[model samples]
Every structure is written in structure tokens, then in C-alpha cells.
Target: MCVPTNAQEADTPTDTPTEAATPTTGYFDDAGNWVPPARDAAPDTDNCPQATWPPEPVSTSERAASTPDALPVTYDGPCGVSAAEGYEVPDDVLASAWLVADLDSGDVVAMKDPHGRYRPASIIKVLLALTVIDELPLDQKVAVSAESAGQEGSAAGIGEGGDYTVEDLLYGLLLSSGNDCAHALAQALGGDEMTLLKINEMAKTLGMTDTRATSYSGLDSAGMSTSAWDMGLAYRAAFDNPTFADMVDTESYEFPGFGDLPSFELWNDNKLYLNDPDGIGGKTGYTDDANHTFVGAVNHEGRRLVAVVLDTTINNDHRAWEQAQMLLHEAYGVSGSVAKLAPANTDEPETTTAAPSPAAGDDAGQEAGTAWNRWWSYAIVAGVLALAVLVTVLSLASTKKRRQRR
Candidate 1:
């Protein structure tokens, strides 16, 4: 999670209690001010004109198991089943929306308000980075446009006409959480409107059902939103790229000055990398509307886990990270016996129950209702080999003791 360094920290956002439309008139200027196109200027492509901000909540079914849209159709677990079964839950988990998922199994191990759509803040930058990394060449130098130089919030400090490589901009976007870096990349990828469209398109393709990208930078005003589950899915997709993995995992980067922009060092905003041995690195996000949001991955005891925490407390010892750490620690050792809750509907926060966690003899428990199959063959093989090795070691040690006794 982020230190007090990130600005835009405030209580949960109250704006757009109803659906807020994506602004077609203009985008944010250098000062992070909204700039409209000229009176006769052609309207920017309104890719998501029908979509509105803080998407209007829809009605859902009363049953948890059959709860419609409880999770994105692409998620592996049962549509309406509680994902938290078979795991020990963390205490005082301050996040209003969070998820802990098994990437290898594609199983959402645990969640709370997983489908609640909330402002994403800088977390939006990750999608922007992925989009750019795919479309633009990292070695290509992009000239900082007026809009980019004028961008506000945490910035890469790109001055007007400062030309930087796509590589540096990505580093700035992910590590520094640079709003200006987001703008530069978005512009490079064909302006903010098109980039937002690309973001949503990728979200659709990746099966990230609740994410809507209206802003390149995650300004609360830009109306970017996603659920905790959506973020975990998005991050999982991003990590597939070697470039993204390299950049996000980097602790710090040294940017070479170009043109009017002087060289500067950028450090990752997330402390999870520095503090947690298992942390695989991810991004941090914050805004008045989003509060403290984070999406990260970790390798715990050889198991890959991705976690998302949204709307966590602002000043409580990085509650999001702490909660994630505690949860990951438990997840590594959890038995497959805890009962699960039914999945809540997309539009509601209600809960339902699932059958108790499977017993040793239970061959057909939680895997019955989902679209995905468990991919535990590799794990089983590895486990067996490890056990065999442990037995051999003990046998050898016992023989040594026996010899000494003789």
C-alpha cells in the first residue's frame, strides 16, 4: 500500500450517487483541470456514451448461489457461491471491498463485497500501462505534449517538449504513480478517449466484468471504476507480459533527462515489495472517492496469490496491506474444509451460504457449480516428491543415530 505520500486521500467519495456520464466535452488539462474542445471542435469518440460513472445499481436475485452478476461471467468459481470457504479470514479487515484469489486454480479463495464497484484511483494506471506496452514500442521516444506537461497530481515531471522513451514512461506510470505519465502514454496510444475505450475493451476481453475506464489517470473526476475482483483479474492478465512483470517488480528506476525535462529517480509507491518476502509487486491507488485501494500479487510457499483491497481506512497503519498480509499468510496454510458463502449479486451486498468445506472423503464439494476445473495435478506431483524427499532425509538421519549408538 501507499505511504502518506500519495495525495487525493479523503473519506469515501460522495459524488455521483447516481450514474455520472463520461465527459464528452473535454479531458483534464495540465493542472488536472477539465479542458473542453473548441465550440466547433468535433466531439471526441464517445466509446462508452451509454455507460455512466458510479454505475447505477441494478436489482439482483435473493438467492446467493444464483445471484445474477455476483461475479464476472469469466470468473472460475460458481456464479453465486461464497468464495471465502476453505480459508481462515483475517481480523479487522478494514476494506469494504477485497479479494484473495488463487491464480493457478483460478479460484477466488476469499472475498468481501467483491463485486462492489468503486473508484479505482491510480490503479487505473496499470491498465493504461498494459495498453501502451502492447501497442507502443518502449524504445520509441515520445514528445511530451501540452496536455501531458499540464497534467496534475503525482507526476513524472515531464516538461513541455521533454521526449522520453515508452520504457521510462511505463516506469513512471507504475512506480511513481505518475498522472502525467498516464497522460503521455494515453496520448501516445491515441488520446485519452480512445485509450479509455481500449481499457474498457481489454477489460471486456479479460473478463473483468465490473471495471469501466473513463479516465487514463484515476482522478475521481474522470470517473474510473472497478470492483476488487475485477482488479485482481486485470492484474493477473497484466502480469502475463514480461515487461509489465519487470517494471512492476523493480524497486526504483533512474530516468535519463531529455530535452527540457531533467533526469529524476522514481520509486515504487507500494511498500508491499519492501516489507513482504512473498510480495510479487503491484500498484497503489488513492482518491477522495476511492480512499486507499491496492491490487498486488505474491508467491507464498510456492503458491501464487493475488489480492485486491478497496476503500480501506486512510490512516490505520496501511490497513489494506496489513489485511492482505494476514490473509495471504492464512491462505497458504488453509485447509479445503471451510464453508463458503453464496456470492452476492452485482447490485446488492447481501450474503448467502454454501455447503461446508469439503471433507477428506468429499470428492464433489465446491467444484460443482463453476465453469473452471481445479488445476491441482502439478501441485499434487510436487507435494508427493517433497514428501518422499523429507522421508528419505529422516531415514538417513535415523541411520546415522543408529550407527552412533552402535
Candidate 2:
């Protein structure tokens, strides 16, 4: 062999080399195969250009134009799609109003004409109880007067001259929806009319602008109206009174003295009493004028919800319970489960007071004139009677003058 160059000269290859320099190694390529350079000592050119490996990203607007967006995420509670579908209410049910609020979060889940004013029947007792609890001592004994005992409808039979603790009356008022209890409490607190004044004042102080009470019993009257919003406020205030809430939720209660007379066992008139999930208590009202009214509360999971249904032809307590359940299920993922509401016994006659009768003078005025030609006949009869009386008096005077002349 030709004489080999010195070892140092052989190791340091000449610039005019027989083989090219290799490319530096880098991370693996997209195919996961190590790519070698075409020239042993040069950069690679067979693979994709290094600059073009990461292509420019497409814009969001372009992607959206090519494909539709995905469906919206599911939401629970009164704000969900199910609530938007609306609950089924009877055709005759006029103006069903409701509001479902989370007590802890103060979030209003559902509202249907929340500010619309409608009659509140025995539901007024809730506020009355609040007033009593706030103003008087619970254990204080109030002597039942004729005014309280003689109250017309649904009496607790706390007879005149009898005595009961305020607590007892509160139970009667809430559990039984007793008109007498309301009257007794009103009279105990303030005399006639003043009770209503106090209720109105208290409502105002509570910021219930649309709430008004003309009677403690919630009887039909002019200017007696409350909105769902105002009722919610009232419910919130009432719930603060543990005694008031406990009394309303109680299924039955017996007074101390009334065992011999008709037992004071009271059944809640609110049909939603047991049926509503987490239902605390409620009240109901009905009349020829105010068809049906309800104000009640349900604990929406850990949240407190108050619902008010007014002017419904159907049993509003049931309808309100259903609507509330739907709202809770749809908006907050609460299960719309319900317990059976206790039914009233058919044997027990539904007790209601007759509407107050008009005064005798008012009745007489209404019946004064008949269409059978009676008006002229009555006028003629009156004129003849007057003439007869005048002639009799003149004849007596003439006899007196003759006697004097003689």
C-alpha cells in the first residue's frame, strides 16, 4: 500500500474530502423514524421542510363557518329548559303566579307575574302570627272576650271569659286557619280596625309594598291584595319565627280545655302541607270572588322556596305544589318528589261562615220599588193616609172651638 500519511494528518480530513459532513441529530420526525441526510455531511432535504412542519392554525371564525357549534350544556333548577316549558295548569285556573327562590343564595329561580296583585285568603294568618309574636309574649294569658270568642267563622271555641295562652291561639291560627284565633289575637293586640292598621304598618316596614291586609281573617274585601313578590317577603319573615312555622306544619293539635267540647284537632287546609318536598307550611283561601289562593314554602334542597298562587279555579294548593316541584327539578336538579297530602274527611262538613248580611235599611231600599205598577200605588197610599190624618186633626180642633164658644 502507498505510504500512509502521518496519524495526525489522517485523522484531520482534508477540505477536499471524499465524503460530505453529516447533519446534526434532532428530535424524532412525525413518522417517528430517524431521518438521515442525503449527503453524509449536509443538512437533510428529502423530508418535509422544517419551517413547513407546523402549519398555520385555522381561525375560530373559519372553523365555525365550516361546522355548527355543539349543543349548550344542561342547567338544573328553575332556570332550566323544563321550567321554560311551563307546568300544566287547568284552563279555568286564572292568573297562576309563582316565585321559587334559593334561601341561602337569594337566587330567584322562577317567577311568573311575581308582582301581580291578588287576594290572599287565610294566608293572612301568617302575617298576623308574625305580628303577634313580635308584639306580645308567647306565654301571656289572654282572657277570651265576647269579641274573640264570638267571631263568626271556624271558631277555636275559646268561649267568652275563657283564657288561653298566646301560644295556644297561635297554634289555632296556624294549624286550623281559625278565623276566631285571628280575631282573638287581633282583639288582644288592638281593638277593631286598629288591628288591620297595625298589619298594614308592619307590612310596610317589611318592605312589602304590594302587600295589604284589610281584615285579619283575609276575608274578601275592597283593597285587600298581595303580590307573589310581597307574599315571598311575608313568607321569609314568617319563616324567621320558629313557632309560627312549627304551628303551620303541625298535622294536628289539641287545646288544653277543649277536650269535652268539640276537640280542637285541626287539619291543615293547605293541600300542599305534606305533598311538597321539604314543605314547611302554608295557607289556602277560596271565595266566589277570589276563586282560590295559596301561599306556601318548600325547602328547595338546602334552599328555601316560597310560592304564591292566586285566582286559580282549580285547587291552587295542588297546582302550586306541582309547579314548585317542576321548578326545583328543572332549575336546581332537585327531585320533584312529593308525599301524599292528607285528604279531608267527607263526613266532616266543610265549615264556612255565611257572608255578612246587609243592614235592614239597605235591604228595604233595594226592595222598595217593584215593576208591577207598585211605585204609583205606594205613593197614592201614602198621600191618602196623610189627608186622613189632617182631616182628623181639623175635626178635633173644630170641636174644641165650639166648646169654647158655648
Candidate 3:
């Protein structure tokens, strides 16, 4: 399929399509909005590879390869309804891969190309946040280094010679989507190399086998990648940590000024979190290669639902968050499933809490910290393990845990 060469960021919805002298490449929707070609077509495989079985693992660990056919057969299609026979998926989703799943029940309510590997952009920050949330103390102070202060995109206003706390940086990281904050936080977690290792380990613990973090802030890296399915798993697991959950929900934070810099307030960049009443929280990201990526959660009728969209282009009809809102709306009443999200892995060695002090040439092969944070163990890991065990027992008891098309 020929993709549109000229794609513009999404604009607010309108009753009529815009007229122009030059013709556009895509067809308008029922609302008369000019949907872009990228929204309606599968991504060019030359740019985005399909999620094949036994994909190249980033780590050399001996774990089993992810099941083929893209986990659940229903989600194997490039374009079709996986929710149910008559369910209508929104036509303007603009994503190459997307998923809507129940965060609490783990049921994959709706999806398309759920396991397609694509760049995650800044949504990968959620993984970094989870990795260090238990490892670093909120009050611990950091001296902003020149590297962090000079980060390329979307700075949180940190300056060299400035002193900030983990809490302050957390605000910048989530609310502002600060790349500078990510770098500073990575340094605190050991260093870039050690932090990436820990972040990938966290991905494994959450059963996100399709994800591999090569950058601290989700920037495009040679081998960095994630999928809609893996993103859903990571987001769902992130909510288990109260600190992460609260940070994403916070709308505004007052970051303290240091040295010659003046104190300034940072606003949350997640439109879903800012707009929807039921919106619990979410993260948004974009890069040239990633286009637009998002992972967000909403509470509807007491059920928490999470949506992930990867490799999307914004159109006049919807932005990444708007597409996510559409998915969540369609999922509220969905009863069928392609497959339940895999439960979090509890056997991950404790590597973040008290790992050996940051040393030279650190890699994944290094030994994990001997001392595990009791709070994280009891609060996060223990709870996740119990849930995993419960899911296993239930699955063993009932063969029909996952729904099939009639």
C-alpha cells in the first residue's frame, strides 16, 4: 500500500472537511474528516517489521520464546474486528498496532496487530519510572549534569549546577515528559548502561517479552522496540506502584529552582489525563520513526481499562490520546477476548533496590543486588506474584478462561 507522504498533526474535530487546492491521499470518514492514508493501511514492513515467532531476544536468557500466531489468533489480522463479529472498530485510529484491555481482569477486550513491533517513543519512560520508583528515595538529591541539562528534546527546565530531588524529577519526567529528567534519573539508578539493563529486566518481569529498551527516554535507537501488547502489560503493571500511579495522575507540579534558574510549574502533557473525567492517567510520545505512541488508562463503571497505540500518525480526526479514548469507549462493553494479557513475572531477581554501586563496564550479566527493598517486595512484587499464581490456578481450573468467537 502506498502511504501518504504528507501527514499533519491531528486537529480538533470539525463538522466538515477542509478544502484545499492540492488533493489529499486519503478518504474522508462518515464525519467528513479527511482521514490520512496511514490510518487505513498497514505500515510498510520495510520500515516496521511484523511480530514473527521467536523474535530476536535482546537478552541472552534461556526463557521460552513467545508463542507464535501473535499470542491470540484473533489479533493476527492486519485489519478486522477482533472484539466480536458485529463490533465496530473506529475507522480513524491511525495506529499500526493498538490494544484495549481490562487492567484489572487482564482480558484483551479489543485489538489489532497487538504484537507488532514498533518504536515506543517516550512511553518507554513508564518502564524507567517503574525501575527506579522502588530503588531511589524521593527525597534523594541530584546534581544536574551537563549531559542531562543539554538533552536534545522536551526539557523539564533542569540546569547544570542545579540541585533537584527525585520527587522533583519524577514530576518533570511524567508531567512534562522531560528527556532531561530521564537522563538525570538514569544516572541516579546507576548509569545509562545499568539503568537500561534494569529497565529491560522490569519489562521481563511484566511479561513484556516483545519489548527492549535501548534508550533512557524512548528516543529512537538502533534496536529499541516495543509492541501494543507489551505496552499494555507494562502500563497495567505500573499502576501497582502507588508512586508511579500518582505521578501520572498529577496535573501540575512546582519544580524548585536552583542557582540562576527560577522556580517554574510544569503541566501534565497527557491530554487524556487532563481532559477525561474518568481518565486515571497516561503517557504520550512521538519521534520521527515512532510517529505517535501512547499508553493510558481510564476507569469506566468501576473497571479500569488500559489502551496502547503504536506507530500512529495524527490526523484532523484524532490525536494519539483521542484514539486511545475511542478504544477505551469501545472496550467498555466488550466481552470477547483475543487472549488475556500474560501475568507479571515474579521470579525476576532483585536488581534495582541495592545493586552493587555503579561500576565500570556494567551489563546484564552483572550480579543482582543482594538486598531487596522490603517495601517493594511486599507492596509490588509480592502482590504481583500472588496475582500471577491466582491467574495460573484459575486458568488450570477453567479451560474457558479466554473467550472464543462463536
RMSD of each: 18.4, 35.1, 18.9
Residue lDDT tens for model 1, 100-211: 7776655667676555666787887777887888899989988788788777667766777776899988998888788878888888888878998998888777666667
TM-score, predicted candidate 1 vs. hidden true structure: 0.65
| Cα lDDT, all candidates | 0.63, 0.54, 0.71
Work out how many backbone clashes candidate 3 has. 0
Which model, 1 or 2, shows the larger lDDT? 1
lDDT of 3: 0.71
Model 2 weakest lDDT span, ten residues long: 5-14
Which model, 1 or 2, shows the larger TM-score?
Answer: 1
Q: Report clashes for each candidate as comma-separated counts.
A: 8, 11, 0
What lDDT does candidate 3 reach at residue 66? 36
Candidate number achieving the greatest TM-score relative to the actual structure: 3
CA lDDT for candidate 2? 0.54
Model 2 residue 405 lDDT score: 100
Q: How accurate is candidate 1 locally (lDDT)?
A: 0.63
- TM-scores of all predicted structures: 0.65, 0.56, 0.69
Identify the runs in model 1 with alpha carbons over 4 angstroms from their true place.
1-86, 258-262, 335-406
